[model samples]
Target: MKNHLKSIVLLVLTSVVIFSCSSDSDSSKSANQFTIEGQSYTLIPDNALLELKMDNHIMDQGQTYDRSSITLSGLNGTTIGTASFDLFYKDGLPVEGTYTITGSLSDNDPDFFDQLLVDNKLCLGWTSSCAVSEAGAPTFLVNANNPTGTVTVINNGNSNYTIQFNGNYRKYDGNFEVIGTSPVVINVTTDVTIQVF
Candidate 1:
């Protein structure tokens, strides 16, 4: 009888251990869940690349709409800037190509200086140094001097699209002259589904 009771207790303990291990594994797997049919998807860069939080996308009657705003942030959660795009759609879907979006420096803060940084290196200086030829539609190029890269959008099935930003853009609080050494390279890929009503 003593031996039987010892065996039963051991079996119960083993079952508890197995249940706990499986529960932990399931939770880890569900952390990266992505629903293609869902309206919104979060993009977390694998290697401390740019952190983009996309939300508040509203579609218009003509299918042409404006993304409420795209929040661009640094790996350490610094607000780089907020960009808005005017998307052109045909037959109820956005055209697949490189679409230019108007992005302002420093979230359009009046107190912030107009400068662009790539990999934490000073790319574009103050408004006086790096003047925009067309104030209405300002476009920046990323190279050795400018240092920032470009963003490309690819179309996936079911209203899903992959947004690839191939550069590390940084933001500074003060003037552009205070930029320090060039930080590490950052490339991020994000998948999102746009809702067209």
Candidate 2:
């Protein structure tokens, strides 16, 4: 026997090269296992389920449109701050693909602020008729209910702002709409009053 059949053919070619290197390391670990799946948005910091709705809006009349709907599932677990959002590869297309979750704290300290509106129309078109509506809720001046004259605030420090509806602030000519976004026939009030300073 030629030296025992050449050492049994070099031990069967070293077991077929260790079974082809363990099948190519299991096909590169299933191609790096990437499967995010239709996950448009899931900003799970303190876990706010996330829900922000804005609707057809165009108000500037008697001004009564202070709407809001950021009911992040009623604060799921609660633990989110320093929040800033803007992530899009394609949505109202602003030629974007930006992300900023720079909050380093173990296990990534709850920071996955995701967003993908895909395209509902909104990529900075704020002047041609004014088009850039979304995220609203801030307009409250109170006196009581009037139409007299006593609105003044020359420069409370000059940040450029003087919206007064004196003598009980005639509802301060409200206009902060965004709640259900449309068909609002006026009657908007979340009840606010903070006279002075």
Candidate 3:
């Protein structure tokens, strides 16, 4: 009878531990995020999209390249912001690795996916006409152009991913003019379910 009771207690304790572990794992899966300059935006799965364009372009006589682009958008109160990146792959889809985000791509190198491009933006409301303030209806727009950064993409399998970006981005206004003399420091980490196309 004592052995039977011990077995029951052991089963209950094991079940509790398993349940706790499952809850912790689920909690670790955070919402996707887009950070630009110094502001952070939380993007839901529905608002975030990752498109894989196979055979997007051809170069080097007849070599085909695939393009993977991710667009993350979210709204903070009345303001809306977006962050996006484009990565080119020589063969197929991009695997788990760290990619350089740069404006320059060399035709001599066959590895086109090694270098990538990133763009970011922040605005007021869903439309361009949305007013931030009544004082002359000023709008805030920023872009990361000719950016130099590193983005680490980890494929968690089954279209799930965790991407981390740390880099210096050139800030450009809506008129495509450099905003400040110094580049903007942007760091973003997001866990998302990529929608492949």
TM-score of each: 0.30, 0.15, 0.55
**lDDT: worst 10-residue window of model 3:** 122-131
Over 47-144, each residue of candidate 2 has an lDDT whose tens digit, in order, gives 32221223323123222121111111111122111111111122232221222222222211222112112222211101001011112423211111
Give stretches of model 3 more than 4 Å off: 1-32, 52-54, 93-95, 105-140, 173-177, 181-197
lDDT of each: 0.31, 0.23, 0.48
**Best by TM-score, which number?**
3
Q: In model 1, which regions exceed 4 Å deviation? A: 1-95, 99-147, 178-197
| Candidate 2 vs candidate 3, lDDT winner | 3
Give the Å error, residue 140, model 3.
4.4
Q: For candidate 3, what is the lDDT?
A: 0.48
**For candidate 3, lDDT tens digit of each residue in 30-96?**
3344555555555554545454443445344454555556545554444565555555555444545
For model 2, what is the error of residue 182's alpha carbon versus the real structure, in angstroms, after optimal superposition?
Answer: 34
Better of 1 and 2 by TM-score: 1
* Cα deviation of 148, candidate 3, in Å: 1.3
Candidate numbers, best lDDT first, in rank order: 3, 1, 2
